[model samples]
Target: MSNYRHHSGYCGIEVRDMHPRIHNFTYVSSCVKYMIFMLNFIFWLFGGLLLGIGMYAFMDKWHSTGWVRLETFYDVILNISLVMVIAGVVVFVVSFAGCLGALRENTCLLKFYSMCLLLFFLLEMAIAIMGFVFPQNMNSFLEDKFTDKIIHSYRDDPDLQNLIDFAQQEFKCCGLSNAGYQDWSKNEYFNCSSPSVEKCGVPYSCCINATDISSGLVNIMCGYGVQEHSVAAAGKRIWTNGCIETVRLWAERHLYTIAGVALSIALIQLFVIYLAKTLEGQIELQKSRWAA
Candidate 1:
């Protein structure tokens, strides 16, 4: 019988030779762990890349248009990007820890790494909820704000009034003065021309009627010789264009990617834990056989 040593309080502990098959199993498990660690590392790298791109797009590269003012929206998007950057960094760090723990067979480090993965998973869920709940409404709110700004600016400017009059006289439209042109595009009473001069075959009037001017209303009237239909059409176009389908697509893709990374990390950690438990069990069994 092999010589026995006391391990802590336990006695008759023999260091038995591991079976060749058990050694092979350990080697295979090690290889699998390494592969999983590499895969997690790749995911971390990609997440960082995505986060950087989002930050640049939201904070550095985007510019607001005349009808798509983003002063408030910019701040919101900036905050979201900042959160994403932080999450990416956390994922990278935790995944690295998990790799190290697996290589070193450190159970403590593995538990901490699992916690990080859970943190990121929760964050992704929160982001997904926000995206689904507010993207469309947020877009519409921004559009309305932009339109209000344009109308308010025009209403406040005397020079704009003169310009509108000139446009109306040139195009023969009653301009902003008539109630018929108040919601001219939607109202059948006004003879508003097509948005395009080529299509309308007529010049548009760019004046506001006195009766149509309210104390607080914004003037949406275009320049003289510009059709009311054209101006209204242009406004609608700007509003629609600002909130494209691309924004929703971007949000959805990011949410999915983040969730996938978190899940992958979790699976890897579980696998490593299983391997450790198996190795421990095998070591115990070998000691039993040697004692027998």
Candidate 2:
């Protein structure tokens, strides 16, 4: 068996990382072959989807670029789109390797795919554990790094402005903090003591119903002077709470779904890693058998 293994090119290449116990003398087990192929195909579809949406969002931003207040309007949305594009490209490359490796029973490609999956699994598990243990910390981190950027750069990009407005309205929330309109003071136009004509007015998104009492056509000024009112009075006119709490509440409501997705991805990575290891062992065994 050692002579046969040495004569064959497979074990000579690398048995260091292959599974210790060989389950099959032939190539990959039928179940592992089909299952890994299917998983890879599913990932391929998901990657394509991410790539498509990323490009679509990027193009939407490009089309709306002329409407932005700034001549150069690169911001979080653009950054997110680019991340999606890069993630999609990576998924495609790794998943394609898995698909082809499983189909052709290539041990090197299988090990490479396994390494990628193991790395992903470890990173995902670490993130999930950290997020679970420090949800508040995660929220605070995102708020400072992400929400603050969005708020400060709201008018710099029209797309970001529209997104913030939608989020505020949909969540029945206003500024980034529970302190409410105080945070809007960050906006030069909405600053409570600003000399500008737009002082003391929140965005139209903060207003309840968002319609003029008389004209009833969408009231662009519905949130005008709302920030100047007392909290009790403002609560009647608009959402007095801030987006952070509402977002936290929303996340709490959907915690199960989020956890399930995180666990599912991690488990899938683990499963791929196992299959790749088993396939590698089988490939080495098959080469030995062929030599014998």
Candidate 3:
């Protein structure tokens, strides 16, 4: 029998004999295919980790609270747990499709993966554009509603409370409103009218030395009744600026770093989409040869 060499273009395998049985030969580039799979796999693992953490947090809160009413759903989403769950689900679904699609060389799955990535990229672009076009509106949303919701719900959830505390300590700022530490008054536990000892007080996290281990012990009650003092007096003990202002300044300082990171993420996504599409085309071409 005479040997007939068959070569398919672009990462196609060489065949010694022109037999239809060679249909199983891989036409896609191994590098591209594996790269896609690995990328999705990493994200898949991350999604699963987020899902697990979210579930644990949610369940722990539920166990501690003993009951969850339908009326509390608004507060639920505002908390980090529910947010994590939603984010995890989205990431998991999209990465799952990508992982399986690349491994199986399934066109439909690859199409779905690429479409999802495109949608995400477009949504991010739109959000970035809107932020630039209407900076005041975006800032208003964050300064007014978003910050208030989180501040109001501060005492309602431990995770959220910790998060706000961490932000306060890290940014060296107190509260989310312009009133600075006085914003804690919005919290039911710290409200001036509240009977709790913590009334009119900000969390320990708002203290200047909250995280300072130099003394070998932290003064958790350092912020107690701090609001009763004037801002001038409190300024000596705690941060006087609101977290909103502090964070805004921080963002401005690191604007270039943030932009670079965002741009890199966008480009990486586009590159992955390109690889998926290229592999899909290569597979289609190989299938056509098989049919011929």
Highest-TM-score candidate: 3
**Best candidate, lDDT:** 3
On lDDT, who's better, 1 or 3? 3
Residue 146 of candidate 1: its Cα lDDT?
A: 39
Give Cα distance to truth, residue 241, candidate 2, Å.
Answer: 2.5
User: In candidate 1, what are the lDDT values of residues 74-174, reduced to their tens digit?
Assistant: 43332434556666666667767766765665556666765666665567667655556786765555444433332233322333335444544444343
Q: Native-vs-model 1 lDDT?
A: 0.46
Model 2 lDDT per residue over 170-254, tens place:
9989987757766777787778788966688888888887976788687767777877889988888788887877887897899
lDDT of 3: 0.84
* TM-score, every prediction: 0.37, 0.73, 0.86
In candidate 3, how many Å is residue 271 off? 0.9
Displacement of residue 6 (Cα, Å) in model 3 is: 16
Give the residue spans of candidate 3 off by over 4 A.
Answer: 4-26, 68-74, 211-215
Residue 239 lDDT (model 3): 88
